[model samples]
Target: MQLHELEEFRLHAYENAKLYKKKTKRWHDKHIVSLTFEPGQLVLLFNLRLKLFPRKLQSKWSGLFEVVRMTQHGAMELKNKDKSSTFLVNGQRVKHYLRNDVDRELEALTLNDE
Candidate 1:
């Protein structure tokens, strides 16, 4: 009788764990934003190296790299602006580089007023 009770409890616990895992996965997937890039697009690459001493104001991302090639496995080949250097990086570590269009627009407006 005691063995039957233990087996039932184990089964219940297993089901609860599976449900929890499914729920957690669903929640995580819901929050993840899908990112994609095209060849010739500019992007910034995230630096993963830990510095000996971190500066509070230093920017961690470094790039204005052009996407030279894209792989099916979520990797990208990036080239320097001058085309002198190239490297392959995971897409997860790169983000689209946003230009300061607003500032340029403001400057244009000011010039028109002048």
Candidate 2:
């Protein structure tokens, strides 16, 4: 009888562990935001591997690169503003770069017709 109880307890424990993992995963995924980029859009690239003794106050993102192309396999081709260089990077490493002038331009266009 005791052996049967132990086996049942172990099964219950395993089920509880699976439930905990599922709840944790759901909570984590809820907080994650999906990012997308388009061609001609400017973006900042994240540098995952930073140099030793890097500047403490500096941002990990570098450059306002323009999206040259996107691939079906989740790769993005980016080019510098001067068109001097290009590189293919993973889409996960890039984020949209917002410029201050964009807001000004929008306000100007909205105020023009009135």
Candidate 3:
């Protein structure tokens, strides 16, 4: 009788664990924001080597690269303005980079009422 009880208890524990994992996955999926990038957009790549150098007061983000294309697996191919080099990185590692005068040029080109 004791052996049967032990087996039943183990099965109950497994069920609880499975339920906990399912609940955690649902919660995590809710919090994640899906981001999409487009070609020709300027973006900055996160510097993953910051911990290697450990410089004081150094920025954690690096480089302004144009998005040449997005891979089928969601990786982005980026190149600098000079097009000297290009590299592929996961989309999560990059963010859109906005210039200080991004809106200035659009505002400057006003249509005249003729």
Candidate 4:
């Protein structure tokens, strides 16, 4: 009957949706990068307040905090440059701060006299 065909189509659609979700999740998890930090390394903390005040040119990360300690479960203790204050934040909420620590040699060009 027509009702039996419709039920079969619904069951097929449901199974396809479940398979799609599983494939998408596996792809996402494969691309994730795990971050590890050492003590005394500088890192930037993600600003959660940015979601409240969204701006086109505003930066999403704020502050340079030193890694004071890390817990086995992805929790980290961070301290500011002056060591004035310390706070515990999830490791997922921070990233390695990129600073130009490399020393590059500068080249000098000589001008030719006409």
Top TM-score hit: 1
TM-score of 1: 0.81
- Residues 1-114 of candidate 1 have per-residue lDDT tens digits of 999999999999999999999999999999999898888899998989989999999998996899999999999999989767898999999999988776443343434554
**Residue runs of model 4 more than 4 Å from their true location after superposition:** 50-55, 102-114
What tens-digit string does per-residue lDDT give for candidate 4 at 46-86? 88873665788988898889999999899999999976788
TM-score of each: 0.81, 0.78, 0.77, 0.77
Prediction-by-prediction clash tally: 0, 0, 0, 0
Best by lDDT: 4
lDDT of 4 at 29: 100
For every candidate, C-alpha RMSD to the true structure in Å: 5.7, 8.0, 9.0, 3.6
lDDT of the structure predicted as candidate 4: 0.93
Model 4 weakest 10-residue run by lDDT: 46-55
List the candidate 3 regions with Cα displacement exceeding 4 Å.
50-56, 102-114
- After TM-score superposition, the amount by which residue 14's alpha carbon in candidate 1 deviates from its true location, in angstroms, is 0.7
What lDDT would each prediction earn against the true structure? 0.91, 0.90, 0.88, 0.93
Scored against the true structure, residue 53 in model 1 reaches a CA lDDT of 96
Local accuracy of candidate 3 as per-residue lDDT tens digits, 1-114: 999999999999999999999999999999998778889899998988637558789887888899999999889999998766888899999998978865544345778999
